[model samples]
Target chain A: AQTVTQSQPEMSVQEAETVTLSCTYDTSESDYYLFWYKQPPSRQMILVIRQEAYKQQNATENRFSVNFQKAAKSFSLKISDSQLGDAAMYFCAYRSRGNDMRFGAGTRLTVKP
Target chain B: DAMVIQNPRYQVTQFGKPVTLSCSQTLNHNVMYWYQQKSSQAPKLLFHYYDKDFNNEADTPDNFQSRRPNTSFCFLDIRSPGLGDAAMYLCATRAGPQETQYFGPGTRLLVL
Candidate 1:
């Protein structure tokens, strides 16, 4: 079974600054995928970024990027130029070479003015 | 527009009462999943359907049941609503097991 853990329960970042949310997982599978999802006050889950384990290069999406450390079982999200819209609960999830996706506890991000 | 849709965004039910939540998808995905999430907690998988075949999580309680009658529709039926069941129910779909899952805006259930 794969388990994901996000140590930070809550995080705050000043608007326009950068913030990183840490996540680590334990999985025996060699091939897998990692993802970051955001849920706002509307309670809608939105995909932020995704990384494939086979790829050594990290994944970057506009203002969001991931530091995917396959060997260390770490995948963290970095939000650059954080905005109010970035204030939401961020979840780190893992999908093994097989398909069942499991999620971490999540970190509630707050962007301060 | 949201590719996945969950109807009755907010529901109010009495204890032991039966409640049903519906999900519809336009993404033409072959897999659909149901998840339960309480306050400040990770979403827990309840069950999922790959086409018409249903797969329930081993730890899922008997109080929760699911059905997918066709390609685009699925339902979550809670036979006996308890206070513990009062939480957001999320529906997700993917083209296949390895594809990214697209989520619908969750339905919030309130048990009284």
Candidate 2:
């Protein structure tokens, strides 16, 4: 069974500062995908970025990036130049070719001005 | 335009009462899914439809049923709402089996 874990329950960052959320997963499959999704107070889940397991290069979208380490099974999200609008619940998800997607508990990000 | 829409953004039902949550997709995706998300918890996949083929999760309760009469819409029916069933219901769609899913705004359900 594949499982994703986000150890941090909550995180805070000063506006314009940077913050990183940690994620790890346990899986045997070599071919897979990882993703980061953000859900604001409106309760809409938005895709932030995605990384393919085979790709050695990390994935980035605008101010969001991921540090994907296949060997260590670590996939962390980095939010740079954070804005007040970035405050939300961020989730790390894993999906293999054969199975349904699995998601972590999620980390609530607070942007303090 | 809302790509994926879940009707009745908020629903309140009494315990043991029957309820139905609706989802419609404008992207015409072949896969449609329903997920349950409790407060501060990750959304859990309850089931999905690949075209007209219905696929239910092994752990899903028998009280929950679904109907997908066509590609653009799917319906989740809870025969008897329970306190444990109170949560937000999310709808998602993918173009195909291996495609990235696009989620709806979600419907918050309150069971009394």
Candidate 3:
């Protein structure tokens, strides 16, 4: 069974600073995908970024980027220039071809001004 | 905007009462998923629909049922609500093969 793990239950970052949330997954499949999702107080889950396992290059979207290490099974999210609006619950997810997505326990990010 | 819509953003039901949560999508995605998210925890997949084919998770309680009459709408039925069933019900739509994934704002269910 594939499982995603987010070790950090809560994290904090000063506004304009940077923060990284760690994630790891256990999977035997080489062809897969990883994702970072942000859920604000509205409870709306928004896709932050995505990374394909075959791609050696990490995926970056605006101020969010991922350090995807296939060998170590690590997919960590880096939020640069964090803003107050970045305070939310961040969830790391994994999905393989023709399979449903699995989510981690989630990490609550607090962007302090 | 192509989006997923979940009705009754907040719901309060008595224990043993029957409750239904509805989800509609304008994305025309091939798959629709329902997940239960307890406080501070990951969302657990309850079931999903591929086109009109209903797929329920093996661990899903028999008291929970799902109906997808068409492509744009799906309904989750809880025959007997329990306190443990109280959680945020999230509806997500995806273009098959992980092309795109979007989640509804989510409905918070409160069982009394």
Lowest-sum lDDT 10-residue window in model 2 chain A: A93-102
Ranking by lDDT: 1, 3, 2
What ordering of candidates by DockQ runs from best to worst? 3, 1, 2
| lDDT scores of the candidates, listed in order | 0.94, 0.93, 0.93
What DockQ, between 0 and 1, does each candidate earn? 0.81, 0.76, 0.86
Candidate 1 Cα misplacement greater than 4 A, ranges:
none
Which stretches of candidate 2 lie above 4 Å from their native place? none
For residues B3-89, write the lDDT of model 2, one tens digit per residue. 999999999999999999999989989989999999889999999888898899999999999999899999999999999999999
Which residue pairs collide in model 3, if any? Answer: none
Each candidate: chain B TM-score: 0.97, 0.97, 0.96
List, residue by residue over A62-112, the lDDT tens digit for candidate 2. Answer: 999999999999999999999999999999999988467899999999999
User: Which prediction has the highest DockQ against the true structure?
Assistant: 3
Model 1 residue B22 distance off true place after TM-score fit, in angstroms: 0.2
Superior candidate under DockQ, 2 versus 3: 3
